[model samples]
Target chain A: METLKINYKNLYFPPGGILMWIIIFLELITFGMALVVFAMYGSEEPEIFHQSRLQLNSTFGAINTVFLLTSGFFMANAVVEFKAKNVKKSSFYFKLTMLGGLLFLILKSVEYYHKIDSGITLETNTFFAFYWLLTGFHLIHVIMGLVILIWTNNGMMKKNSDTEVVDVEACAAFWHMCDLIWLLLFPVLYLIF
Target chain B: MKKTLLFNYGLLILLTISTAVISNFVAIKSLAIGLIMGLSALKFMLVSFEFMELKKANLFWKVSLIFVLFLIVLSVVFISN
Candidate 1:
């Protein structure tokens, strides 16, 4: 009888941890489903969708994209530095990541204020309904990511803290998930419509 | 690793600018939308593979991520058309 061997190196082990990846997948699916519904309605009311989309500031969306991507880059570096046992450098990168999250929230809030001032509300139309729901949900995720990053950073800052590498990696994974969600949202909301 | 990450970062920025230009300045609507979505997928891949370290992850995760992206993009494009 021949013995079968499993390739351990190629086997799937979720980055960060199993639970974190599960959460990531669930979030992605939720957003993806909402986007699909948005698209269906968009096709049904092309003119409305197009006009509503044009009212949005793509420039602001682009700027937010840059901010989130740069933040994600810094967060990734934080994980790398942590793995290399450079706790201070990792914490610095985490701070940068949080800054990026703050900037995104500020810009998004400004955009929302403009919409409200212009008399655009969730009840304004189908497009605006999605506009508020999708982006607002994502904003919540960003806030959560920032909180997690801060907690991870604080843990790292403590003297003789027993913060494990997995904890930091999990935070990084969550931050990157936020970036990924934004990547999907930006194009669907700001560009493609 | 650092050099590779830096290179990816530059690529992401370049892609972002290109997406903006294509979406805002391009006269052909279909072409612009197509390019924008394509660029978005590329950006997503870069972030997942590099920043998220999905490149080193299991085949199941990589495939699942790509599959979800495909579904979303396809649905949007299909509806728009």
Candidate 2:
């Protein structure tokens, strides 16, 4: 009888793991449903949607987009370094990624402040309501991603720790999903009507 | 790999800039919408395939992610129209 061999390395599941991917799918669907509802409401009140979009500071949205993308880039590099077993470099890159997240939070808070000062609250209108709900939910994800990245970085910095490669990859995957959600949100809320 | 990451970063920035310019300068509403959404999709793909390492993922994951994006974009475009 011939013995059968399984090639574990050739398994084609997503980075992180199957559980992470399942969570990612669910998150994406939730955001997608929110956005579809947003679009439907916009269609119902075209003029209001258009006017509300104009009130948004696209410049801020554009800056936040750059920050998130850059952070994502750093996170990607961190993962690559981790795969290469370069712990110090990976940790450094993860810190940079966290820096980007911090900047995004600061800028987003400023934008929110300006909106609130201008008397734009969630109850202001349907557009403002969606804006607050969608972006607020995403902000919570960013906070979670930052925390995960910090934990992963700490693990990487420790010598001979049991922090598996999958854990680091899972952190990166979650952070990238945050970026993905923002990419969709930016266009729908800031650019298009 | 470093070079690929750098290239992806540059491409993402370029796409971001182009989308902003198109949406701001283009007079035709449909044209602006089409260009902006198209660029957004392109950016989304770059991030997914590169930063998210979707390229190394299984067929099921890749298809699911892309399908979700397609549905969202289609829904937005349809309802807006």
Best by the DockQ measure: 2
**RMSD of each candidate?**
4.6, 3.7
TM-score of each: 0.95, 0.95
Worst 10 residues of 2 chain A by lDDT: A1-10
Q: Which residue segments of model 1 deviate by more than 4 Å? A: A1-12
lDDT of each: 0.88, 0.89
TM-score of chain A of each: 0.93, 0.94
lDDT of 1 by residue, B19-79 (tens): 9889878888778877888899899999998888888878888898899888888777777
- For model 2, residues A1-193, the per-residue Cα lDDT tens digits are 1122222234445677778878988998999999999999999999999999999999999999999999999999998887777888888899999999999999999999999999999999999999999999999999999999988788767766777777888899899999999999999999998
Worst 10-residue lDDT window for candidate 2 chain B reads: B55-64
Question: Looking at candidate 1, what is the lDDT of residue B64?
Answer: 87
Candidate with best lDDT: 2
Q: List the residue pairs that clash in candidate 1.
A: A12-B58
Q: DockQ for every model, please.
A: 0.70, 0.70
